[model samples]
Target chain A: MSAPFYIGYNAKMPPATAAFLRRWVVALFVAGAGVAVALAGLQHRYGDGQFEFGIVKSFDGIISESPYPNLIVRRPIGTDAKDVRSRVLLVAPGKHGAQELVRGLEGRAVTLQGSLITRDNQSMIEVRPGTIAVQAAAVAGDDGVPLGNFTLRGEIVDSKCYFGVMKPGNLKPHKACAIRCISGGCPPVLVVRDADGMAVYFVLAGSDGGAVSSDVLDKIAEPLEITGEVERQDNVLVLKAEPGTYRRLE
Target chain B: MTLAYQAISWNRQKRVYDTVMAGGVLTFLAVFVVTGLVLHSEITAEALLIRALGTGAFLLLNVVLSIGPLCRVDPRFLPMLYNRRHMGVATFLLGAAHGGFALVQFHALGDVNPLVSVLTGNTDVQRLSEFPFEWFGLFALVLLFLMAATSHDFWLANLTAPVWKALHMGVYLAYAALVLHVVLGVLQAETSPWLVGVLGLGMAWILGLHVFTGWREWCGDREHAGATADGFVEVCAVADIPENRARVVTLGGERVAVFRYDGKVSALSSVCRHQNGPLGEGCVVDGFVTCPWHGYQYLPETGASPPPFTESVPTFAVKIVMGQVWVHPRPNAPGTRVEPAKIG
Candidate 1:
């Protein structure tokens, strides 16, 4: 600092005088980057990724159909509470195949032991080839009694990311990602409003609950109306639509 | 420069310059983290850091790519170009951080190797909509790493300027990969329109500036190239060049920037020593001929960098014949103090 800062505008630096940047300036940068990497590594909080591995779990519920020819376990909300779709245990048919296992157990209480995997709070039990036991004989079950058949409008969203993983994953912006997740074997879900306009989530299944994910992959994240049999299976409410029954809405 | 080139020649100005830049980077991270916590209290530390670094790297890359054409348009932006390599290296580190975090978050603890998982996890590349977009980001990050690793002047000298320039140009391909990475990966998962908008605008701005600057320079070069008289090429009149501006002319296959300033006309090579910036586009500031790219200055008459700086460019002799200015087609050795021709 001087009384007069006599500046020379003509003082030019030689180009070869290329001063390599100061070492510590780079060191500081390297140190900063190292810290960020360390923190991320420590936060090693990993996810099961798009698909969760099949883990065995014991589930008890009455086998009933939403609209699919197959069945989902309508587990009671609690020991005494009435059953609802939110507490449904969507049953994927055992390796024995769907027809034989669900031949006459539509209304009966059944106990199945299999590997259970879940996403978006919805659970599924892939029955271990021979672990399904019928606790009660077949009776008049509420498996798609054609409570009503009408056109319903809503969106087909991948259950995994839509429910809680990512906020607003059901929108158009997530349309493509939703398609990928569903294609990867996550169960496709249809979100629609009931009489009172409450959002109800139905786990989409084939006529045999085989894999409706492939069938509806194109419909994920799209608003659509489908004509199907709306049935109440104990607590699991389902819409059973045949292939090609879903129509895309603008 | 030798094979074992010194990392950097530290100087007073460069130290301060880098210190300020480093401070800005840290400050950006702090603000990003604080805001993310306030808005998304449950957002993981890893998620916040990964996102912040990813965005920071992208923004810096845009700045790096935009600097060339920006300097072409106006020399005032040259200061940013001075330590642009540092910015590039920093961008690569940020990108690496984002990639590392993502790898740890999704691929670690699996049966397969983490890197292998990154490759195989999203093997749906055969399908258009389900292509492995994350792999594109990985590829781009690898390119960025190669760029940062070879950013030193030692590499430049060893590879030769032309080869170095071509190799660094891989950044454009890397940029394309990143665009696809974001569109297919985050755009699908995030459900946000703002990121896509910002990406679109940044791309448009960078590409538009390059096209505009290139077109203008090409047109200017072809116009009034060689109208010779005697041994000198007739350039525009002293009045044709604006005050403190230049009239560029190509003669004998050399581009000369004939500047008219302070009622005197001086000519120098159009190429800047720093990054071959167009000196003709840069105006004299405070009596020094400043490069429009990195603000490297020269004494107009001698084409010499001021004492202690040592950089220089070739000077040309200018004469005013009739009303038009003429430049001697021969170039004088760099730093030769030729007298400026007075404009009448």
Candidate 2:
């Protein structure tokens, strides 16, 4: 409300006292700054460890079923056959040594030789040289169907051949049955030998594909000689049966 | 003008400032403790309590520094200005706790020497970008310690006003360093943006208020000097004096306390040296003029305190001639320059 008051009142003090207090304040400031710097430094220094590479091999083994072109070989450490242990030797494409070794082999086979390395406690062989061998089979007719209790013998012409019957009523049969019938034109029927050297009814299916009745299904495991034509298609082996093509072996 | 009146006013203002400061400090401490305890996961209940106490103390100091100037600017806000030094002391104690806890947490165990680890643990010395932020904190704490030590009236009396005032001014420096310490050290190291923002804002607010007040004061001084230099110097027409009443006159940046008592006009410094209480706003209850702010009584004739207070103010030469009051711009020693203003 009143005019702003400014008093020019200056107090006199002993210079010594002033100096002491100033020094004290300065000292405190220095100490505080020191502590802050120290703490920051400690945190930056001691804080936390940082890891890279994949699993060379797993403890679990691999599983494979088929061979050669249709070979479903499972490697011990991996799923695919290519991942199986093999050598990595360098050789010319037309080199006879590697070719001769593969030609002499019977079925799907691979041999490799190379140095091995261990990663994460798993062994991995880096092959220097390798060879793969495969064997070929024969062929048969398209619509030959073997009768019941026939000794059917045939080389596999199509390795992927299906051997099941058609459905009874519909012209279109179930996929599993139709694939077997159309691919080979007949199912690979089983045969069994009796006490006499004569072909007897083992298991049979009608022309129209239907379910295998329990009466015949019971004798499927019996061993018998089969005679038919072996067929190969799409790197697969199949057999086509014909009437009287199967004969009981004495 | 009596000593009793001055003492009463001084006691009243002191009480108000003290009480407000103390309450503010306690409240801040309570909040700080509760928040700190809730926030800290690793600290035990006891440690949390201690840490809270420490935090409260530092907060109290901040409040103390903030409220004093605020109260001076507006006395209506006096209630908020109480016990500011108490709050300051509390803040110092809180800071001590924070420092102590940090010391124990980082340096208590293992092969590393505590002192060396505190200084070099984080390899700050090796890093060029990392500065001596810890030094700032240390300096701030030391400043606080000095302030707390000299807070009492005993140190005040022993150190004298000028020295004590100068020392106390370190609060501003300490606060500045503390702000930098937090910014460069805590905010830089800690990635939490929200926390950094809050701390920065608080510091900015305090600085902004101080700057505003300082600017206002400068503007007021300029305006007053630009206006009339001789107009207000005339205290009164010589015939106007009725008995013991005093008149306030402003002349060239000086306030003159003019009094007409016992058939003569006398002049003394209108501003009280203690807290700048207006002397002219007071009255001559006896032979002395009492300051309205804290009622510091000065002998109207001598411009000197009666006894133990030992306070004094400069007296001005005056003339009474032809029913006009006139005063000389130059001030003279009290008791010797008792001549009345000439009447015109």
Reference interface contacts recovered per candidate: 0.02, 0.00
lDDT (10s digit) by residue, model 2, range A49-162: 100012121122111111111112234332345544321111111101122223333233333333333222122232233323232332221232333332342111111111
* Candidate 1 lDDT for residue A22: 39
Error (Å) of candidate 2 at residue B36 is: 4.6
User: Can you tell me which runs of candidate 2 are displaced by over 4 Å?
Assistant: A1-250, B1-26, B36-58, B79-83, B109-129, B222-232, B235-267, B270-295, B318-326, B334-344
A153: Cα error in model 2, Å: 70
TM-score of chain A of 1: 0.50
Docking class of 1: incorrect
Tell me the tens digit of each residue's lDDT in model 2 across B104-220: 543333234545545543333433224445566678888999998887655655788678878989998988887766665544534555556545666776777778777765654
User: Candidate 1: TM-score?
Assistant: 0.60
Question: Where is model 2 chain A poorest over a 10-residue stretch in terms of lDDT?
Answer: A164-173
Q: Give a tens-digit lDDT track for model 1, residues A169-234.
A: 455434544555565454577888688966776656555534575578556665688877666544
Index of the highest-lDDT prediction: 1
Predicted structure with the largest DockQ when compared to the true one: 1
Predicted candidate 2: interface RMSD? Answer: 30.4
